[model samples]
Target: MALRVRVAPSKVVLQNLITCLILFYFVYYVSLSMCCLILQVYELDVLAPFDFKTNPSWLNTNYKVLLFSTEVTYFVCGLLFALVVEEWVWDYAISVTILHVAITSTVMLEFPLTSHWWAALGAGLISMICGGQTLAYCLFKDNFIYPDLGNF
Candidate 1:
């Protein structure tokens, strides 16, 4: 047994390692970059910063590009984490993304980008909490307890 699944010694450990890397490094990078975008939006008074920001006919495509890129990264991370832990919560993933995207984008578009950094911190915390369990599973696979409660 591995750390989390209580079986599949090698496979679970290997997968756990992958989960840690993806949840931490890959997702971490994307979220870090997003902080900058959030900062700019907040400064420029743009709440729905994820929509297209262009002239009426000239394709205000900046916001769309940002949302698409960020959403893809967020969705991928959520999907990978769920798959690794055998916790395929499709509804949860969609809800989180849709809620965040709609709220952030619409707010930025209609109102002033007055959201503070504290809100962004909350987002980061939520991200970590959502994915932290899977990440810990992967990282602690090597130092694991067997079915008999024996440590390796």
Candidate 2:
């Protein structure tokens, strides 16, 4: 026996498609960044220790340049998408910015200082809050049905 599925409304389907595309873009962006970091940057670091170096020369130069350019273009395009197309994307972008700040702070602070950790922690906290709001806007009431028992 074959199972049947109910077709969602056109608008709901469109929203789901848009959300999927946004998720796909994020995946691509992250994969590109990781490739650049691991293959192009770390592996090609001439000054790095022998164990740390991979001596990746095959397509590294061109790939790295392309990756950098594409990453920037992707970011700008995502911002434009958020600004002009979807309001929820804007919230996601803001949350992502908070995460970026946290990650940047953590990466920059090499010393074992309490203050540095606190700064990173604060950014992470803000990111979590904003991220929750973004989640609500994107998933809970927007796409799926749920209760609206007062302001969260």
Candidate 3:
């Protein structure tokens, strides 16, 4: 006897992956820009989202706000991604976060090394997954209902 494994067609998978990536970054930047505008209202650096500095004190109000706003943006992006993708929430979430980190590292000329920076990234990742799962379930709970097998 042989067991057959089924996989999605590569073209379809690739297309979906590309769509997810594009959507994730598009929503992320747009939301981040809005957050930056709010930060600017308070005279904080508008470029804080791009800063990977390890030297600044995380205790600073500016840093705290930046971190909070970033996490919120991640959550919103994840929620939107989940609503669109409607499947493979974990894979897409991790892929986008890794891509974001890689791009940020390349642009900043250094990998983020600060504990607080990493903590924020970790928190953002968690929020992304949680928000995605929560919204997806809420929107599609009926789809997940299983039929009564005992009646078979």
Error of 3 at 120 (Å): 0.8
If both were scored by TM-score, which would come out higher, candidate 1 or candidate 2?
1
Model 2: CA > 4 A from native:
1-30, 33-86, 110-152
Largest TM-score belongs to which candidate?
3
Relative to the unseen true structure, what is the C-alpha lDDT of residue 87 in candidate 1, on a scale of 0 to 100? 40
Please identify which of the two predictions, 1 or 3, would achieve the higher TM-score against the true structure: 3
Model 3, range 11-119, lDDT digits (tens) per residue?
A: 6667767887787666655666666676663565445566667355656656655676678877887788777766556677888778878877887888878787778
**Any runs in candidate 1 off by more than 4 Å, and if so which?**
1-49, 52-68, 83-85, 109-152
Worst 10 residues of 2 by lDDT: 46-55
**Model 1's lDDT to the true fold?**
0.46
Compared with the true structure, what per-residue lDDT tens digits does model 1 show for residues 1-152?
66774667677656665554446345534653565475443332232334333322225344433443344455456546555544423334434444555554665555324343233334543553466445545655664444765664
**Candidate with maximal lDDT:** 3
Give per-residue CA lDDT, model 2, range 1-152, as digits (tens). 99998777776546644663565346445544566565555433321111112223446553443334334433443444433334445444444444444544565543234443344335533543354445445544555445698997
* TM-score, per-candidate, Cα-based: 0.31, 0.28, 0.71
Total clashing residue pairs per candidate? 12, 0, 0
Clashes counted in candidate 3 amount to: 0
Q: How big is the positional error of residue 92 in model 2, measured in Å on the Cα after superposition?
A: 1.8
Model 2 misses residue 115 by how many Å?
Answer: 24
